[model samples]
Target: MAGRVLRPVGVITETARRLSGANLHERIGLKAPPGELKRLADTFDGMLDRMENLVGAQRRFAANAAHELRTPLAVQRAAAEIGLAGDPPPEKVARIRTRLIGVADSSEHLIESLLLLAVSEEGLEHTSPVDLAALAATELAAAEPGAGPAGPPQDPTVVRGLAPLTVAGDGTLLGHLVRNLLANAVRHNRPGGRLELSTSADGVLRVSNTGPVIDPADVPRLLEPFRRSAERRHTAGEGAGLGLSIVASIARAHGARLAAEANPGPEGGLTVRVRFPLPEGPTPAPDSIRLPRN
Candidate 1:
């Protein structure tokens, strides 16, 4: 009787001791009658399942990050090598220099995005009141500094359907959320497509634009790090595929709801909506709080 009770405990202990990254697929999978020890073994198996999933996610993120960071570095190295080879002419040198600068700038943007994503994942330490409507209008109105010769001319027709809306969160992260939404919308749009955004006092911000057709099933995956939609690859000079993922992380940090849907029209596009929680209390009248005009 004593041996029978101790047998499962000993087995679980031994199995746990032998577990490692290479063996996450292994399970205790003990066969026993229903009781406290049986319950314990089942719980242990469940914990290992979660651990396996978490470890797998970290591994994937690391690989993707490495690959993304490597691309710009490789470009920089190749440009430098060409410049130094055989004493290049002044014009060629200048072009090489310019290319290097552009690659460096791209690297900087990627790093900044990675840092913001990291900060968002750690959760917010403090909170402040941020007006979603004003941020959307400001970002929508601002010129696209990223638009170089090869980039889009920000040509999409813009419509402002904003209302004064406020939510509690880090204002910077919230601003990035709006900026990224607008940028993603604009970058993937058609030449004469229409861009629209609206903010409601009820804590919802929505941006929609016209672009290439996308599968509805890919929407969720697009929110993951480095995931890009096949249809939306028209903008080759656009982003490192971190735009929507950062938005998703910031939304999670702020305890907000975020959704992206592919447009059903003939001209394909995406509509991303973020819903933040409104603070408890009556919202002040529009006249009471000064907001940015569209």
Candidate 2:
């Protein structure tokens, strides 16, 4: 009887000692007879599995972040090196200045995106009634001045479905979500492409853009950090591939459902829709309002 108890204890000690330096990827688990000892072994194994998953996720995130940040830094370094290499004339200095400014702008955008992503990971702390439709309109309007001739069609049409489509969430975060969506829509669109923004009484917000067709299979990967679709390759330096990922993160933080669908046609485009749960209260009247055609 004494040896029986001591034997199990001895086995547990030896198992733990052997596992101390063992590779976490091996998924090694202890073997014990049916009883409290078996339950203990199972619990230990489960913990190891969870730790492995967490470590793996952290490693991936670090790798992706390093890769994304290196581009702008490299651009900045090259610009500085070229500028200092010679006594450049006024025209050359101006050109170099412009290049540096572009690099600076890109760096600023990347930092802001990284901060937003970090905040999203922490989750939302406060919530209130927010008018997503109005927010969408405001963001779209703010984006107009930056929408150059090379961007989406000038004077893009606007179609409003439901007025005061309110959702319960952090107003600032929700604004960021809307802005990112609208920015992506305009940024990826063709010159003559059309953008449509609409909201439903059911608490659904949709932004659709007529641009390069995206593969349905690639949509999932596009939402991951630092992952971009084939269409984005040509416009590589314009963005750091965090727009949609940040949008997805904010949506998740707000407990909203986000879905991306490819447009139906050979020309190809993408529509992103986010649906939020209705707050407790009377639903607003559904009205169709269309802005004057641009």
Candidate 3:
């Protein structure tokens, strides 16, 4: 009996040593005879599967980060090269200046987004009761910079919120989540399009925007880092495609559920809803927060 048990252990040790040289992306599962050794083998195989998935995700994230960073750097380099080539006329100089400034702005936004994503992955540093409705109102009042000037002159957002709708989470991260959602909605909207933001006392936050019709299948991809719709790709300064992904990350950190769907109509759109669980204690006072009706 001792030899049988010891044999399985010996085999597992040798197999592990042999496979240790394999890359993280490679999955080499172990097989064992029926009995206690089989259970150990199954557990080891499950662990290998998890490690593979984690490594795969990290690899994709690294590749996407490099690609996103390269674009802005390339723009800046080209602008510098053009400016250095010769003494340009006033109009050309002004154009170069504008291009450089735009590149700088985009780079800054990308860096900020990356930092937020990294910090969120590590987990929230602080936690408190945050009023989602009031936070949304504040973000709405302040127009997001660098969203491009393509939309209609008039603001198109409709806000319907219940006061004192709060959740226990890090204020900074929660605020970021709200701002990202709002910015995304405004940036993607068409000229004279409509945006609806609503928050309920039950800890539900919904942001819906009118834009080009999106395929239902594409909605999931939109929540991944560095994923953008074809239309958004053409629109300069829209964003680095990290808005919804960061929002999703922040929501996960706060234990909230995020649901995204494409709106149904001739002019299609997207709607994202985040449902946060209420705190365990007493609730705050009720106050209605409404934006000016369109």
Candidate 4:
């Protein structure tokens, strides 16, 4: 058999193009400049880099979440096994029960953290307009540690906005956002420490507590999932390192902004300020939309 061999041909264009026609031969064509190929290659490279970072972040988040859950889960299982094996002394049983409660509480906390994260990631499409001042007040009331045996009065700093400023986002998630900030502040503060929260007319909310200064270097790192500063880890109470990360995620989801700084006041500590950009113009009252009451 006789065959004819043809050499490869080159084609170039100023811009990308695609052509379609009834005939199969003319159905498809794309035009591009010489450098377009290189530009495309660069774009592919950038996408790969972004994908790598996303995958790394996901792996790290999963590992850290597992580690955080394992401690409480292990304790809960052990406590259950002990109870099932035999009936211990009343005192011993009570201690085991107490330990089990702590484990259960930790589990609940983990679930709450996961829920908050999921909701924030889902974006604010489902959220209605929210009044930050009212939301903050409600969160503060619910976040109180409750009265001590002495019945010490608990007063949270409250700031009422000039008008009912509304933000388009999930109120429950925003409440969690506020609560997380307040909880972290209260939990990490010194004994008898002071907490102050303020809401500006421009939809900015600030929460500050008196405690040790957060090292400047650790500020950004603290916002990563499951990351806790060495100084923060020394403070009282069990923190799963999800606090500021949740705050950051919520802010991003809602197009809100968050700011943090070290307070120079005598009652020095880290201050976190979340500034929510007010929706343009008058905020129409949401019809039949309500946030979950804490």
Q: Please tell me which predicted candidate would have the highest TM-score against the true structure.
A: 1
How far out, in Å, is residue 48 in model 1?
3.0
Worst 10 residues of 4 by lDDT: 3-12
- Model 3, residue 194: distance off in Å is 2.5
lDDT of 2 by residue, 107-216 (tens): 78788998999898789788888888888788877875335644333544554454568888888988899898888887777655577888888888898887787888
Clashing pairs for predicted structure model 4, backbone only: 127-169
Instruction: State residue 72's C-alpha deviation in candidate 1, in Å.
Output: 1.7
lDDT of each: 0.86, 0.77, 0.80, 0.70
Error of 4 at 92 (Å): 0.5
* Poorly placed runs, candidate 1 (over 4 Å): 1-13, 30-43, 143-154, 231-236, 282-294
Cα error, residue 93 of model 1, in Å, equals 1.2
Number of the top-ranking candidate, with lDDT as the measure = 1
Q: Give lDDT: candidate 3, residue 25.
A: 39
Q: Which is the better candidate, 3 or 4, if ranked by lDDT?
A: 3
Model 4, runs deviating above 4 Å = 1-45, 80-87, 145-164, 231-236, 264-268, 282-294
Clashes of 1: 0
Which ten-residue region of model 1 has the weakest summed lDDT?
Answer: 143-152
lDDT of candidate 4 at residue 85, scale 0 to 100: 61
Cα RMSD of all models vs. native, in order, equals: 7.5, 9.5, 8.6, 11.6
TM-score of 1: 0.83
**Residues 1-294, model 3: lDDT tens digits:** 899668767766765676642554343344555777777877766777787777777778899889888888888898889675787888888888898898888888889999999888787677887877888888877754335555346456464555568888998888899888888887777766788888887889998988889999999989988888773373474577889999999999998999999999976789999999887875655565455799
Model 1 Cα lDDT, one tens digit per residue, 157-266: 78779998988999899889889888888778887678889998788899998998988988888898887765345234567889999999999999999989999978
